[model samples]
Each structure stands twice: as C-alpha cells, then as structure tokens.
Target chain A: MFTAPLVVAYPYKRTVGTLLSRFFQSLQEGRLEGTKGSDGRVYFPPAEFDPVTGRQLDEWVTLAETGTVVTWAWQSAPQPDQPLERPFAWALITLDGADVPLLHAVDAGDMARIRTGSRVKVRWADERSGGIRDIACFDLLEGAS
Target chain B: MARRDVAIVATAQRPNEVGSTLTSVELILPVINDVIAKVGIERQKIGFWCHGSCDYMSGQPFSFVAAVDAIGAWPPIVESHVEGDGALALYEAWVKIQTGECDVALVFSNGKTTSGPIDRILNLQADPYMVTPLWPGFDSLAALQARACLDAGVLSEADMAEVAARSYRDALNNPIAYAKENVTAEQLLARPYTTAPLRAHDCGVPVDGANAIILAAGDAARSLAERPAWIRGIDHRIDTQRLGARSMTESSSAAIAAAKAGVGDDRIDIAELHAPYTHQEILLRRAMNLGEGTHVNPSGGALVSNPAMAAGLARFAEAAESVFSGSADRVLAHCTSGPMLQQNLVCVMEGE
Candidate 1:
C-alpha cells in the first residue's frame, strides 16, 4: 500500500469582463446593479449577453438590496467555504427591480423562518471585496413569513 | 447516402463502492480487458480510444493521460478525452464511426469520488465569477432546484421518496449497485433531511467505479456479439448554466434531446436515467415524457451507484445490456451533466 498527500493548487487571476465589470464594481461600492436584456428583463449580477436573444447588453439598471425569496433550501449542516458557518438557507432571490433571481444565503435563525416567498435583505460583508461575497448573506426581514 | 449504423457490442464495469485502493489505471484496466475479452477483439483493431474523466476528481492534472497506461497505447493509438461523463465520449465515438474513420472504438470512464470532496470540487464547474465564488456544494444547489420543483407543484416530497424507494428496491437485484434495499416510500419519508427538502435517500450515493464499452459499426457489430444494441438515434443538448436564468422545475434540454432522438416515435420498454437525485428522475421522466409503459431504472439507475464520470456511461451500458439480453426491443439511455440537469444526452438503442 502506498500513501501520499496530494495537493493541487492553480492560482487563477481572472478579469471580470465588460458587463460584469460594472456589476462587481457596484457590489464593492455597496450598490446593486443589473443589465437589461433585449427582452427588457433585468438580470442581476448582469449577464454578458441576453440569455434569450444572445445579444450584448449595455443598459444597466440599479437594483434594491431587499428582495423576495423565490425558493430556498435549508443547509442544516454547513460545509466549508459556504457563505455562513452556522445553519442557513440557500435562496434564489428576485431582488427588487430585477426580473431574475440571485443565488445567495439567508441568515434565517431556523428553517421555519424562511419559506418560498420570504422577504429578505442583503447583509454586506464587513471587509468589502469586488466579488459575490460582497453581500455576505441575506437576513430574513421581520414581519414576513 | 444512408446513415452509418453503429452498435454497442460489449460492456464491462466494476461493482460500485465507497472506497478503493486501486489507482485510476488499476481501476480501469480490468474493465477494459473484460470488455475486450467479452467481444474477443484484438486491442490494435480498436480504431479510436475516447476516455471520459475529470482531472479535478483525480486530484491531479492530465489524469486521463495517466489512464492511457491501462490501454497500453502502443503504435501510437488515436485517442481523445472529454472532461465529462463517458456518455459524451460514446457520442464522439458514434460520430467517429459515422465519419467512416473507425469501424470499432473503445469508450471508457472512471471516477474515484472518494479521492476528494467531490461536492466542493464540482463547484469549480459552475460560473467561475458568480456561482463558484459562493462555493455552494452540488447537493445544496440541487436542493435549491428540488425546492423550486416542490414549490411549483412539478413534484412533491412523496413523489421523490417514491423514486428513491423504487430505485433502492430495484438495486437489490443489481450486483454492481452500491446502494440496495427493500424500502418503502413511507419509510423514506420518515427519514430526516440531509439538505432540507432532500433526504439522504433522495441523493445518489457517490462511489469509486469504472466502466468500459466497445462500439462496432455496420457488419462489424453483426459479427461481434450475439445481439448488438444498435444505436438508432442519439442527441445531446445543454441549457444555460446561469442558475437564475432558467426554469428550475423542467429540463427543456432533455425534452429537446428526447424529441430529436425520436424517443416518442415508438414504444420504449425500459429507460436508464442518469438522475443522481430522486427529484431529477421525476423531472427527466416528465421531460422525456417516459410513460408508465417504460420500466425506469431496472438497473436501479445512478441513485444507487453513481460513480461521477462513469455513471452516465453506465446508463448507456445498462440500457444496451437490456437490449442485448433480449429483455426489451427498444430502450432509452439518458445521461445528465452539470447542475439541475443543465446538460442532457439521450440515446435510443434497439435490437435487430
């Protein structure tokens, strides 16, 4: 029997392209933005091109941080590198003013607190970075089921 | 000119298991040898060699290159590798034969899931900028999709439970299946959720395994096996990788592939769906429109013995095996790759 440690590390430095450049830049500045597709649907975290028309999108639409959870799954056991260490719900939220949903975590105290249509808002990370983690996770809003 | 005829003549696989002491080449060598022996063909006669595997799962780069040692690439064999499931490689081989380039081709795949954290490693396949940064495990992403299907009334927990129950029961007869039991849907529903809305039963048990398939064209296929599973039609399609851009409840790509592959043109006796998740089985059945007449997952499907890179090809082998065994006249072998069935391959095989 042979035993050896295997470590594969390939550091990647990628440039966020034309459309996503503005989106990630806005995230770092505590603002959310989406691009309008040719079909007039706003896409948060802005896609480089319209999914339906395959047309390049340049029109940017500012979006609100607050959003409604379209659907979610409770992560009772947190895995490494997840948004949250403790239990949380992974949600697809249709942020206000965006037609499409954004996948993020909801810091609902328990699974009972979050549902399909739960109202939630983004909780920006303390140390800001131009990445998806800029929004640490979504915190469930009070007075909503 | 009419389309070239291609058929799967022989196939071999190891029993799915959680851990393995064998290296990639060691895992693959026997299956390749077994398949070649089953057909009694000389290795040099194998026109092209196509391998399907993930470098990430192997914990090393150029992993497939090392696997070629198992094939003993002498006289410089023409070979290609796909960083996906073996079903895709089978598609490539099918095309190779159609081009009149090869009369016979060998397609093989291996996945040592226990070598690494497969769930986390698969995240790298997601959108590097958006989805991958979140590091959402595949199971978590699948749970999100399952919840959407549940919320949309496309499927229910009970429906998912029933799929698992049936798969588990079916696996009892499958010697190579990793998970097998005589379980009931009610019993499965009683189990707690591993990821809410998804119990442990709902997800495929990952295992270390390898599989090999031999493909012969036209008359070459006729002389190879007593009954060769002829490839009638095969097609593969992919949906948008964006999690939010598409509908979670349905697999449009699968429906398109099934339609193009002529799944509904005639009666299907059995279907081997590469659905690792129970909800995905239901989604694929609906997408492919596989009705009550089809015996779904008689080999217990991937939910019982999912070996990542090899599972999809196993579906192909299982479906063809049924045809070769004269159990069914026509069968459908479906393979899904990426999250939420983002990519789908449909192969309709039949007996002469």
Candidate 2:
C-alpha cells in the first residue's frame, strides 16, 4: 500500500454572521451572551434566528459563567485537537438564566466527579481569541449547591 | 397527495465491506449496471439520473462528478446530484416524476467510510464554531445521547444491548452485512464500553459500499416488476442544528416525519430504520410508534452494514425487498442525517 501526507485545509476566512459574530466577540472578552428567542427561551451560542419562529432575533441576554450539566458522557480517550488533552466529560450544560444548554467539555478530573445535574463553571484560557476555544473548558465547582 | 404514483422498480447494492481498494467509479459501476439490468430498461430510456454522495467522505472536491463515468454521459442526459444520502436522491427522483418532468429516474450513492478516521471525519458534520472546534467524534456524541436516554428513563442499558444483539442475530441472514454473529444481549453486555454507556456493538459497522435504486411512474412501474413497492407517502423533516437546545432523549423530527409520511394510518408489517447507534434505534422505535408486530431491521439495518451515504437508501431497498418478495404488504423505512438524528426522512411503501 502507498501512503503520503495529505492535509485538508481552508486557508481563507469567512464571516460568522451577525449573532454568532457577537457571541464569539463576547467570549473573547471573558463574558457570556445568549439571544432570546420569540418563545422567550434564551439560547447560548446565540442563533441568528429563532429556531421555532424562523424570525430574526436581536435581544441579547448576558449569562452567568456557571451552569449545571444536563447530561454527559465520559470521554476516556481524548481525540486530537479536542478541548482537553487528558480525559474529560463531554457535557450539555445549561448556563444560569438560559433555558437551553450548550455542548462543551467538562474537566471533572475523574468520572466520579461529574454527573447529571453537577454544577460547572467556565475556565477561561490564558490566551483570548474571538472563538469558542476562548474558554478552555468547564470545571467542576466545589461545594456546588 | 402525489401528482403521480411512483414506485421503486429495481434495486442493487454492493456487499458492505471495510477498506475496499476500489475507486468511486469502480464501486458505483457494478450496482448501476445491475439495477438497470434487473429492470431490463434501456439506458437512454431513463428520463433522469440522480446521484447522492459526499465530497468530505471521498476526500476530493467534485468527487461525485467523477462517478458519472459509470453512467457514460456520451449523448448528454438529464441528471442531478445531492450532497447527502442516496435515500434523499430517491426522494428527488420521486419529486421529479411527480412534477411531470420525468416518468423514470435512476438514483445511486457510494462511499468508503472506512478510508479515513470515520469518528473524527464525522465531527465536521457538527456545528462548525461550537461543536466541531471541540472535535467531539460521532461515537462520543452518540454516547452522550445514549446517556441522556438512560438518565431520562426512556431506555435502560439492557434495552440498548438487546437492540445490538438483535441486529447481530438478524445480520446473519443478510449476505451483504459487514457484521454478523449469533450473539445474545447478555453476552453483548459483558463486553467493555468503547464509549461509556455505548459498547463497540452499539455503533454502526462502517463499510465501503454503493447502492442504486430505480424509480418509475405508475404504468412504467407495473411493467418493470411483478410486484412494485408503491410509494404511499414520503416526507423529510429537520430539527434544530443546536444539539444541546433539543431533547436528546427523543427524535422530534423523526416523529414529525413519521406523521407527515402517514406511518400511523395503517398497520406496518416491517420497518427498516437507519439508526446507526443502538440507542437511536430504540429512540426511532418510540418516535415512529412501531408496535411489537412490526419486524424491525430484518435486513440487519445500519448497525450491521453502514456505508455512510448509501446506508439510508439501503433501508429503502431492504424495506422494498420485503414487499417485492411477498413477505409484507406494507412497510416503513426511515433514514437520519446530521448529529443525534437532527434530520429524519420517513417513507411508507405498500405492494399493489
């Protein structure tokens, strides 16, 4: 069998659109923002249009850095380019004040530490960029109520 | 209501295999030839040609364009392509016939899912900014869904194991299935988890394969086959792209599609669901309200031989084969796209 190095890359950049552009920009500033849908449900990773109504949404709501894990799966082996180099839990976290949850990695240190309904807080990356990676991952909160 | 009745006249598929060295054209040509020969239709007589495939899976831009060589477009013929699964291409052909633009159409799809890191490659299908950046593979995402189902009390681990066990048992009769063995649910539960709450058996057996299906209008269909699987109703629906925003335990789009496709209108003898994960099959069973009487995944379904772009259409072919063989009068076939069953297509077929 023949083998060679092949790289699939997109060198060019594209705009993130109105709502998402703002969401990422806010992330870089070490804050969280969500867009309120017509149904009054706040969606994290703010969508440009209300998912149900299909209408444009501009109402922005500032969200807390802490959230509760709705559900999660333990990732025993981390894949390349993942949020964490070590083992972590892939979780759907509902940020405080937001009706909907967002998917991200949770650095629970061990499987026993993370569970459904466990509280987690964002752990900001030292280096800031206008992207989801700006927050390295979520961390388990100590003595979480 | 359909403007004109459309039926699947002929279908052919390459046996699912892992890491086949054949090129796209090589994989597609045989099936294309086989289906056409089965229908005994002249190549030029086919009013339209539709193809379904993915450039990402092929690792080349315009890869589907190269597959047209199998059809030999010398005189130039009416054709189309979908960047998704072959079942969607069949839907397009069905619509083409309904539009009075064509009486007969050819639909085909091929993919070598095992050529690359399938789990990592599938991560691209997720939301680019939010989920893709994290590089969460398909298995992990599916495991998350499985976990949610477990937490919600929708299904237990024993139930998931039973689905995998049944698929393995059913696949033994299917010559084309990649994975087949007479295993039990208890035995499956003994294996270690590949992704927690989801054993290796829970995931689809990815393979390199192709499938072709022929569609013809009322009279054309009657003449082509002794018994044609008439399309009673077909509908596709999509849920929100935001994965976490939707309920992971249930497939709302699947329910919507099943309703729109009139799945509950009559008793279904069989159901071929394209659920790659064992949990998803359980979820789809609930979504479509498939009763105990319905024989599910008799052809082993996606869990046995999942050829990415072709698996969905394979469900259609399998369901139709049941009708063609006089085994069932009415059947339901379901296909899913996007992560966690975000988009779903349901088709109900009956023999006349």
Candidate 3:
C-alpha cells in the first residue's frame, strides 16, 4: 500500500498566564517555586487555581531544588524529544517544602539507582530559558540513598 | 425532570487489524451501512448523526468532516462530532433523543491508529505547558501508574498477568479479536517488562478499526430490535487532569460515576470495561465494587484489540449485544479517557 508521512503542525504563540509566567521565570533563574493553594498544600510549578477548591491562588512559596521521588517508571529505551537521550526514570517528585509532586525525568543512570523515596535535586540546563525544561532533568543525589 | 427512555437497538463493528489501507470514510462506511440494514431502516430514517474520532490519529485537522461522506451527505443530515470517543457521541445522541427532537440516531467512530506513531502522538494530549514538553509515551505513563499501584500494595505482578491471561483466553471466542491466546498467568509473569512493572502483555494491543451503534427512543427501539438493551442508567465523570494531584492507585471518578449510574442497584451479569491496561481492569473493578459474580470482558475487551476512539463505543455495543442475545439479563459498559483512567464513563443496561 502506498503511504505518505502526515505531519500535523499548527505553530502558535501561547501566552503563559501570570501564575505560570512567574513559575517559569523562577525556573530560568535556577530557583524552585510553588503556589499556595486554598488549602494548606503548596503545588510545585504553581497551579493557577486550587485543584480541590477551585479557588484562584496568588501566594507564591519558594521551594528547595531537592526532593524525593514519590513514584517512577523506568524508560529503558529513550525516545526522541525526551529530556535525556539515555535511559532514565520518569518520576513524580515532591520537592521539599511542596505538598504536591512535579512530573519530570530523573537521570539515575541505571534503574537500580532509583526507587520510591529516592533523594534527588534539580540539574539546571546550561542554557537557561523561561520554560519547564529549564530544570533540564533531576539528578540522583550522591550518597543519598 | 422526567427522562425519555433510550436503547441501543443495533450495532456493527470491523474486526481489529494491525494496519489498514482504507481511508477513514472507507473504514466507517460498511459499519454504518451494516447497522442501518440490521435495523431494517432507510438511511434517511436516522434522524441525527454523531461521530467520535481524534484528529491526532489522522494527522489532520477536521478529519471527522471527511468521514461524513460515508453517510452519503447529499440530502443533508443533522450531524454532530466529538473529538474524544464514539461513546461520548453516543451520549450526545442519547441526549438528542431525550430532547424529543429525534427518535432515531446513528453514532459512529473510526481510528486509524496505525497510520502514525500513536505513542508519540498521544503526548499531545498532556498538559501542554507542564507535561507535553517531556514527550512522555502513553505506555510510560501507564507504567508509572502500575508502579504506584504496586508500591501501594494495591496490585501485584501476578494479578496483572492474570487479567492479561484471562483476556487473551476470552479473545479466542471473539472472531473479530486481533490478539488471542490461551497462555496461563504464570507463563506471562515470566516474561520481561516492556516498561518496569508492566509486561508487554499487560498493555492493550493497538489496532486500526471502526464501529457504529444505532439508538432509538421507547416505541422506536421496541420495533427495531427483538430485545432492546435499555440504558437504565448512564453517567460520565472526570477527575483532575493533574496526574499527581490525585491518587494513582484509585479512580474516585469512576466510583462516583458508577454509583450515579446505579451499577450496584442490580446484579451485573456481564461487564465490558474499557481498561486498556491489565492493572487498570483491576483498579476499575475495585472502584465500581464489581464482585466475582460478574463476567468481565468476555469479548477480550480493549486489551485484545484496542482501536482508540472506537474501543469505548464497542464496549457499549458488546454489552448491548449480550443483552440483545438474551445471554445476559443486565450488563454494564464502561469507557475511559485521558492518562491513567483520569476520565471515566459508566453505562448500565438491562432487558425486560
């Protein structure tokens, strides 16, 4: 059967709202931040509104670059456009001082190196941009099992 | 407010295939024709036409518009479209009938899943700012859920394998099933993980296929099929899109929808759950409080041959077929969307 590649593309500029704008700016500056929800919980990457209460949030909380993995899935074969070209674990890490977790890649080098509750810290990208990828990926903390 | 009774009178489906050379119109035409013919009704008699499909799968915008050609849109017809799943379109048709504007309606869906890199394509559905940048594959996300379930002591590798083994065995009886086997859970458990905590067998086998269902109100339904599968109760609920915001081990939205749909009101003879992953079947069963008395996924379910947009509607079709055939007294059909069963729709059906 004859076939041709269909590339679906619609390029447009997206204006990141006030909350995420601050969050992305903080990431580019090599600092972690979270938004305080209506409830006492602090959401990393800052939720514009509380997930449970649906209340708009504006209170920002500075968070540590270090965190612990809540849960993770190991990708043995990395795909294109992923954070890392090598094998890594896609983890949900609850950054210290934040109640909620952020989803990002953990460069653990090997599957055995990562686990639930594994300590990790942000590895800032050398060329910083005001985006989520500014963190590049998390690195497993040395001697912190 | 009083609600009008709606029943699924007829359904037609294409067997799941690894890949198909057929265009969306060609794929949907026969099933639409078959369903209309099965009900012994003229195409014009179908008062409303609602379709469910995804443009991401087709790699084009407004792809569903081209599919209406299969319905022969010459005389002009009342039609609608949903970007999600055909079951959601079926929901709209049900609402249309409830409004007394149309008595008979047709719902169809087609997915050319094999045309593109589906795993990579699905990443587009994630939160564009937060999650989409990483380009996480669908299987990787599912594996993450599986790992959470495993860590929380809610599921085990053995349990996941058992669901897969049972589904494969059940698929042998389904002629349209693309993947079927008689392997035991033990043999499956011995296999290596495709993604940690998830074996290849634990995931649904993706296929290219299409399906259609016809809906009619009260008297119209009675006149069409011998025993109409009455939709006694139906409800759809969604959880927070933030994957980390909610518990990955449980589906509270499914439970709420199941209760609202009265899933536990009467004993369920059979349940066709749209769980793409083996562990998700276990999770949904728990959420809905389905007991051992219910025969689950006798048609092999999405695990055997998942055709994306159509699989969910096929669950409705399969459950209705069981009721129509008199093999089951009361049945349940379920459909889920989003990452990790984030959005769920539960439908309960019964026959007199």
Candidate 3: the clashing residue pairs are none
**Candidate 1 chain B: minimum summed lDDT over ten consecutive residues — where?**
B113-122
Candidate 2 per-residue C-alpha lDDT over B309-346 given as tens digits, one digit per residue, 9 for 90 to 100: 89999999999999999999999988898889988999
Error of 3 at B303 (Å): 0.7
RMSD of each: 1.0, 1.2, 0.8
Stretches > 4 Å off in candidate 3: none
The residue-by-residue lDDT of candidate 1 on B125-211, one tens digit each, is 998888998888889889999999999999999999999999999999999999999999999999999999999999999999999
Q: Please give, for residues B1-352, the per-residue lDDT of candidate 3 as tens digits.
A: 6999999999999999987989999999999999999999988888999999999899778889999889978688999999988999999899999999999999999988888888888888889999988898888899989999999999999999999999999999999999999999999998998888788999999999999999999999999999999999999999998878988899999999999999999899999999999999999999999999999999999999999889999999999999999999999999998889988999999998
Q: What TM-score does chain A of model 2 get?
A: 0.95
Off by over 4 Å in 2: A3-5
In order, the candidates keep a fraction of the true contacts of 0.89, 0.77, 0.82
TM-score versus the correct structure, for each prediction: 0.99, 0.98, 0.99
Q: Cα deviation of B161 in candidate 3 (Å)? A: 0.2
Top model by DockQ, which number?
3
